[model samples]
Target chain A: MTAPAAPQTAPSPAAAPAGAPAVIRAIHLSKVYELGAQQVRALDDVSLEIGKGEYVAIMGPSGSGKSTLMNVLGCLDVPSSGEYWLRGQEVSKLSEDELAEIRNREIGFVFQTFHLLARQTALRNVELPLVYGAVRADERRARALELLRQVGLEKRADHKPNELSGGERQRVAIARALVNRPALLLADEPTGNLDSRTGKEILELLDRLHGEGHTILLVTHDPEVGRRAARTVRVRDGRIESDAPNR
Target chain B: MIALLEGVRIALQAIWGQKLRSALTLLCVIIAILSIIAVVSVLDGMDLYVREEVAGAGANVFTLRRVDELKVLTDLQVFLDSLGNPRITLADWKALRAEMTLAEFVDPLRSRSGDLQAVRDGRSIRNVDLQGRGAEYPGIEDLDLERGRHLTQADIDQRREVLVIGAQVAETLFPGVDPLGQKVRLSGRHYEVVGVFARRSNVLGQDRNIFAILPLSALFAQFGSFRSISVQVKAKSLGDFAAALDEARTIMRVRHGLRPQDPDDFNLTTAEQFLTLWEKISSGIFATLIGVVSITLVVGGIIIMNVMLVSVTERTREVGLRKALGARRGMILFQFLVESVTLTSVGGVVGIVLGFAAAFLIGAFSPLPYSVKPWSIVSALVIVFAVGVFFGLYPASRAARLQPVEALRRE
Candidate 1:
């Protein structure tokens, strides 16, 4: 299966709808967790489609299974039943290593806590995925530098995660997420740890990236955060409560 | 290859993050390898020193004495039994000198060790080993002359009061003056120094350059008759050595009137025998030292394993992050292995340097000579690498086996 490149133009409007050329296609996906003698259904028949260059947000309250849906969509976890396709490959049946390759080549993740390796400088953290991807050192450096420049953290390239402020750390994480030019930028509460002003800055960065034809998926509990996306999908009780384009 | 280099970089960073813990772990590795290299170097040095210095007899020469030093050392009962054997008399030496056909030279030796002092005016040297030798002594042994000539046949036959003093005695008794033709008193008699032997290295703390050699006739005139003499015999060629030894043995047995049914009382010592004896002693020391070193390395290896286990646990989330970034299981394992090997190899290098310095100091101050073999250093590195792999396997695999989802979930 070919990697889905970032489109050169904005996605074919919002609400990519069903049966489109999707970056992610989930068909009746379900996930179950056995907590000792009790079985908790984390995802129940959750089907979703994300198209190239589309910016979508997954939102839900605590224990609402939105995190579970993001995990399945990001190839971090496989569903208990049903097929999840990413970039035309049936990823639900892929092996751990194959899934890891997909995650590296097709999806990029920005976490809530900005899980940058504390020991590495900002540039090293951005170059990490490419290092694992077996990219040459010079090329990895050039690409990571470009992404750091794009995130406006080029001046702080040599600084460690602890040396950066919360907003700068999140920008570094964003640079790291986009360094690979992944098909989908998956952000799980990317602004959860930031103040409103810094959070708004991060949201603007994501909006600018969406305008550049990069597909974006934001998972957050904040309705205001969800409202920034062109499309919002609300999850509740292991099921999709609503998935519709924002006004 | 690139991944391994990256792994090394990361490993160094991780190790630097926990300075105290890594230091303690490295200490154990250093001590273990230090002991191994030091002991091996000293043993190797001693082996070479003994081969060159203690085996003083020429390849074609053998000595016949009253009791066998080898048998006495190997068995205490042999020591007691040999005390009862008759002394090798000068008459027996004379007979062997006349009857031996395979021998090229037959020289009689008589040595006295205790309270033997050489005096020149007021300057005196104590604990000087005094030896009585025939004119053939220089031919049977590789004795070098630093000045003047050795004793001639005329000097030995006419009982001339002549001596060949070692370099140490020459330096002490006649510091500014020439020792040749100078009178030195030994055994209550004065003898003119004819020659000075070349300076020699010490053997097992025994100074080789403090002795004095005298003509056999002169020694007897001063100290009475010879008792338990050792006759040094040299064969005509390398091929004749065994034949000459057998002929001398037979001649001594006949002279002592020993029948075929009775065991010979005298001992025959060759250059080869001396080497074999030295080898036996050195090998025993080597084996014992190696045994102790192995235990230390194992303990060190265990410490490394424990430290690695803790490191793996501490970096569980980092491992998850790496996996999430597309690091394969093999890459993870390789990373950890590189870290372990790097740690041990550092310890090994430090140990080798310290051990070599220790050996060098020992050689400088003592009788042993230091030898640095490239293979020994290579083998030491290989050993530490093996230990790292052996101990690092469990913890590295534990890190590799961690599920990325579970690991990322860990707080």
Candidate 2:
């Protein structure tokens, strides 16, 4: 057989415009949690770059480093070793207050459990991030309502979390995540608690958001969910196994 | 402002969510505030009643008497006697009226008790104590006569057998008989009842309404001796009352042969003095009761802290979620603190209402004096708020220091 020719490179029309910054960059990041006598290396020597407006999924099995990486990216916790630069800010070195500001202004988080405040209405849940942002009351209400409308939850805005169905509650959480108009949307198993059909709908909604130039980072264990992303990163036993374009 | 309102809203919602626990927690604060209010109200009412009694007794009157520090000491008595006795007498009263430029009137009174009897239409009354006085007695003392006339100078000069029976005596000896102008036999002698004196309400447990008033000559004739005499002096104006008293004292000292350095050998009791005594007694009770109530409040505060600590543990996941959603430590601390204060303040308000109701019921139906003071209510509120803040600090700090990841993993 003839030796395979070198793969041809094609000029792509969808390439990022010049000078667009990477939305997230992690360099040699590591997280070690000490539990009594033993230490857990949740993330070890992880380095990744996600460009602006990219939809990326982190796929891993249980005990993998995916959740640790998500937490570091979301500024919820600092890496034990190395730097995380989120939108040009050294988030790993930031003070807790600064990290909170970044979390409020830059990253929107959607958890798998849909952690909505139980006593608060869907509209109030959406307004919570604005409360932390110190937005004026009227503006917070208006923006929260608009975000709930964007998630197709305007009619259910007055319903409390316990009163909402699983899909509707997840949608309220999504609206809450987007209420601050964050630059990056981070979802950790956003469809883990949903029916397959509802999960597909959520993925479609996220895809539409990505099409509108929103940067999205989704952590999941399902191959189907990973395939929907433009890029897929696989983690196992605290290390990334492979990273490649999803197509 | 919005943050504060939101804090309050969330705090109230949390309290509402755990209604039974909230009510139980609030009970401690309520009891503390109620204790404070009850004590304060009773003291206030007692003070008011004492002040009214003293003012009614005499606002501008002062009595001067000898003060001996040693009990049963002959030297003090000899010294008091050598000072020539500042005991008020009729001559001293005349001198006081003459020399005191500020004196409006003066009267010397000597009390004498005897087995006096009054009979009307075959009914008889006994055991009356008689107070004999000059014509200035009515104006010098606060006595209201309901019928006929009081003793005049002519009555004393002629030794007329006229008497002013007190309301109790009149009611007893001549019930439905109109004691005015009626004849009543006293100590084997008959005296016409010229007037019936109105009842004098008791002060500090002494009833003035059970005695009879007779002319000074008649009491002297009946008793044959006087142990002590009281001088009542009136001043033209309140500003001059003290000056008039001083002038009367000087005139009495000169008449009684007292040295300039010798202190008056008589008791001087003024309305102001009685008020000071009353306040001292009431405030001592107040201090003791407040000390006990303070201990209760401290206990209440500790209970609040313990409950809040448990709350922090119970809601660890909620705290983690809040921290993960960009909540600062200060925000977490403030939310918890607001909840504590809200709980305490609600308890305080309830306590105040209950305290007032209790006080009103006591005041209306019982003999124990009770009146709630506005300042006490305000102070109780402040104390409750302070206690809440003080006790809430530790639990709030613990909540704020919780790591989001650790709290999330706490199941």
Candidate 3:
């Protein structure tokens, strides 16, 4: 258990206007996973557009393919058919290594499980993305320390994941996600494992990041969580049911 | 280089995490390398010792004896057959000395070795090696005198009962006093000491300076002339050696009157032949041992491969996470390869140290000397490093080829 960190100065917002061009454009994207003799449509003809500095949530029930949609959007899995263009680059047909490079430079992922490496300290976890980016050691440390400070975890930088509480771990994950300064921040059920009080705190942290003009695409099944986003897209049976603003 | 360092750091953590398993794997590698190092070191030491101390004094010299060959000691039938060969006598020595153009010296020597005693001033030394040599024996062998003189042609012609004593014999009988002109009793007869040979250290752990020598004629007068003798012959130079041997062999065959198709009745032992025989024996042993150690090393390598496979399986999710973080397949492969190399190299170093200790202990307690050859150390390290790379390839590539999404999805 640890005391909550003091709030620091707010992070600068992303430099994109309200009517900026799209950051991600999925045109007729379909993902079909083959299991033995059966083919499951994980994503079916999904067409969507997300501009820079927008906070959007894709919501659905179990088996509705929201996770698959998030994976495709995060460049983790390729769609079976479609033209997926990210920042004017057609990436749906990219090679494995090239996609990995795209994921490192253009997208940041925050998993539901808070997937922090168990052995490393919080500071090292925050520095993980920068390490893959081939950042120099001194610069990597300084950037990681600054991100930790932004997440109000500078005082706990040396603590491993097992020593931190659930909320602190999620905060460390958020710090790691932003360390690369990616174009899109994609989180899957970011507050799924926290209590109501801690969950609210994480939600507030997400809201603060969104307010800073960061492009946030969150995936969840809970409507109350979806209601926090500025825009919501509903999916059912691998197809979008509705796309609308929260108001 | 960064990947190499990180790979080593990760490997150490993994090894430390599984202490007993890593230790057992390392032990297997150590034993395999230790046997090779120890055996090579002993062989190297013995080769040098035999060449310098044992065979060096007899360089350019060869011996003609009644026995057919040195290998007669290994076969009973050969020994029995050679027993019927005529004794090498003074006649053969004289013929070779007079007829050979390539010959430097020809000396006849007869040895008596069982339960001989030398007594001087009532002080006795038992089991003394007693030998009789012709006047030119010193010229054919490294028989330097500590004082006085060697046997002269006059001593042999007059049949004088004069002796030359080894340093050990002199020490035991004369102690602090001068041995020159002193009388020592041997075989119920007294002989005046004319010379004393300088002290010599042991060869193959057996002392050399424990013998007494007498003039050939005087020895025949006392012990009769029926004993088997060896004719030692030296060539003028290395160029003359082969021709000298051929000439001596032809002369002896003519003297014995052997038929054209018949084998020679006597044996010839040269310094080169003795060294070659030793090399054949030592190399035979080394080849068999190396074959065995190679199998052990391969087994050790298999163990490493198995352990690495287990490690990759255990860390599948971590590999997925690393891949997700943008680590390429080559990076993953390099990391695991570095790990395996570090493991085997560590084992190689430990084995060399332990092998050196084992060699030193054996040399200290026994007659076989020990030397650590630089090439052996280099070869041992190279062998283990190659094992690591060869065995580690499959597991590392398996780890590298893992699909990132599937690996990450695995619980």
TM-score of each: 0.86, 0.81, 0.84
Cα lDDT listed for each candidate = 0.85, 0.79, 0.84
Clash count in backbone of candidate 1: 0
DockQ of each: 0.51, 0.43, 0.35
What DockQ number belongs to candidate 1?
A: 0.51
Best by lDDT: 1
Query: What TM-score does chain A reach in every model?
Result: 0.92, 0.91, 0.91
Query: On a 0 to 100 scale, what is the lDDT of residue B213 in model 3?
Result: 85
Q: Candidate 1 clashing pairs?
A: none
> Please, what are the lDDT tens digits per residue for candidate 3 over residues B1-411?
544455566667777778898888889889988877888888788888888877887888999999846565346787688889998888888899899999899888888752333455587777888888888888887878999999999998899999898999888888899999988887788889999999986766787988988888888898899977899999999789999999999999999999899888898889887887778887887788788878989998999999999989988887887777666777778778877877788888999899888989888888778888889999999999999999989999999898877787788
- Could you give the candidate ranking by lDDT, starting with the highest? 1, 3, 2
lDDT for each residue of candidate 2 in B1-411, tens digit (9 for 90 to 100): 666676677777878988888999999989888777877787788777777764555666664433322212324665556345444555655666677788666666776665555555655655577888878778767789988889999998887889988888888778787888888887788889999888876543455677788887787777664455666667767898788777766766666676988766554446675566556667888889899989988988998999889888988888887777777888888889988988889989998888888777777766666777789889889989998899998998899888876776677
Residue B394's lDDT in candidate 2: 92
Q: Is candidate 1 or candidate 3 better by lDDT?
A: 1
Chain B alone, TM-score, model 3: 0.85
Superior by DockQ: candidate 1 or candidate 2:
1
Q: How close is chain B to the truth by TM-score, in each candidate? A: 0.91, 0.80, 0.85
**Model 2 over residues A200-244: C-alpha lDDT tens digits?**
989998998888888899999999998899888888888778877
User: B377, model 3: CA deviation in Å?
Assistant: 2.6
